[model samples]
Target: MAFPGERSQPRGTILIANPSADLYGSDRMALEAARGLVSLGWRVVVTCSVDGPLVPQLRAAGAEVVILDVPVVRKSMLSARGMLSLGRDVLTQLPRMRRLIKDEQPDVVLANTVTLPFWTLAARSCREAVVVYVHEAEAALSGLARTLLTAPLRLANGVIFNSETSRRVSGWPGLERRDRARVVPNGVGGPPETLAARERLDDMFHIVYVGRLSPRKGVDLVVRAAALLRDAGIEPHVELVGSVFPGYEWYEAELRELVDELGLAGHVRFAGFREVVWEEFAAADVAVVPSRLDESFGNVVIEALLSERPVVVADHTGLAEAASGFAAAVLVPPDDAEALALGLSRVHEEWTDYRRAARSDAPRARRLYGPESFHARLSQALAEQAFPVPSPSMKDASWSPREVLD
Candidate 1:
């Protein structure tokens, strides 16, 4: 298992273990972390269970990507039979993970999410430093499930949470006393130039929702909100710009049926999955994130703000934190279609104010969530766990913000 860039005198090596290869929120954050490590002159190798769109992006950023049969813990695998399967996977995959770590001789093993608990355990058994980057905040989990999910954190040398809400909800013992635990928000990339809101040539107000179409994401609420607007004589066109998980196809079907039931079949459009959503935001009068569950953080809200589009988001947990202090964003109660519709109506009535606020706040959003800030903070966090801080002379000459953002 020879990896590329086998250097005799590299500064250090880091192997990042991630659960998925899809280019979703956490997947994009993992890619950014790899780019950050590469910029710091570390030999970056990323391992995933399967390959998808994120593999090439990692390689292009100077990180090596390896596909392996990594054991991942999912919520559906918490049942009796599922627990047996998980135990079997741990028994079989642990040795391979240990061997890989021994072969790579990495300075640190970074488990990207709690789902890859086996990676942390393997690294510890090898006497290697390990860090867990947590991207989930499952408040709905049972007591037994939550304990099992966070048990791996005790073995980690350091832990990074995406938000304060996430860290608080985790409730892991000694986390408050731990010096290495930190909250680093997701770095979201946006269009090169912030485009102004497009003028409407017709009576239709375009709305866009850009994330997974699962029930937790509350896509059905978005559809129902559009129906409410129509019933009140406001013509709104809703575009859902993402798809569902592997087994959640039925949820998407239900959404479509709900649209037809509310007589919004002509108003709602399923735009499907998209890698780039700036064009969708450009065409939308407003963006909505109506998640029913607690999101660790809201990357899409930041994306909408960066795109200079007014946003309506469910105000709870990380979603509230993401939209906080952004005047262009309107917050409504979670899972309330009427409240969401009212928020959307408020933005429509005061369209001029919201538009100006969005344009005015675009630069601030860039300053806070841009790639440069994200890479700097993430690299520093990982570097601290791997080794001492590098001096100015040790910085990589080829490292640039443009390279990572691209």
Candidate 2:
């Protein structure tokens, strides 16, 4: 019952809970946010799967990161094992969370992502109002996750959604979550200075996609698009970055077969999940985001633009709005292979104009979407919810760009 301004606890702490760590955009962003929070001198704690790509980075960032053995999203959607996994998630983590409550007594419980916010509900019951960060605009929530968020979202002192689209998708309409739902776009670290500049620009028309090979991500669209290009006497080199998640092996295999059937064996390469993925983006002429659904704020597109690379995105979700802002990117119909292929060719044909636009937009993004702004906005939101205050510069832009980095 520790609602905002109803308690007198001076010392404050926050626990960030997540159910995954597959080195995807969301996971990467969570790591950045955690590290930024620590630098701000806030005692932070993060709990996720025991074997995540982020553990070492978390430890280095000066956070008390605890890797808990929990069941993540299983491949077999509805199975006895999945039910048992959910039970273990609730039972196993609940006690560990109870113990942390007694020891640290955090002032706020901030669930980093939506998929695993039961931890927030549990922690809020013991502590203050929970602050849940909704990263995905519309995640396929299980019955339990749906029940968990609906009422408690109202119960929590605050909710921070990545975009207005996300808050609405979660069913908090008319800004019911808006009073507390502050939109603090993610901040990305500046691309490494050593990122490989595109040297084979004239030699090859390479199209790169940097995300997991999941069905919703629309990697198949890229596969099909590659075939379309080949048919039209164009062979664009396509590179895929990021590893397969649990239960997504079948999808990965299907993608592999599609690559073979399309005769794109040499043209399309599966660069199996590298830790540092920017180098691949750097080496390509264009970055492609062929997502069919669930891209609340596609961070990869911005990263592509950061390197002065043009992007071809599905003309839906928040990405289209994102791509339009700087005029540094191109918007094509979602999952349209022919359109995607045509877009790729245009980037090759008119490289000068696109690169010219990206050069102007990249610096503006550095100030607006970089780490400094993220920390500043997040700090203010946490403080405002913890205390009380008002809000930002541009009130709102109708479907404009919103970030989701760290």
Q: Where's the lowest-lDDT run of ten residues in candidate 1?
A: 1-10
lDDT (Cα, tens digit) per residue for candidate 1, span 42-139: 79999998899899999999998888888789998866677678988789889989999888978788899899989998998888888899998988
TM-score of each: 0.91, 0.84
Give the Å error, residue 211, model 2. Answer: 0.8
Candidate 2, residue 54: Cα displacement in angstroms equals: 0.8
Model 2 regions lying over 4 Å from their true place: 1-11, 70-92, 139-151, 174-178, 194-201, 387-406
Runs with alpha carbons beyond 4 Å of true place in candidate 1 = 1-11, 79-84, 171-173, 199-202, 388-406
Q: What clash count goes with each model?
A: 0, 0
- Residue pairs with backbone atoms closer than 3 Å in model 1 (clashes): none
What is the C-alpha lDDT profile of model 2 across 28-116, one tens digit per residue?
Answer: 87788778777776677877766677877777887787776544443243345564666666776677766765566565677776555
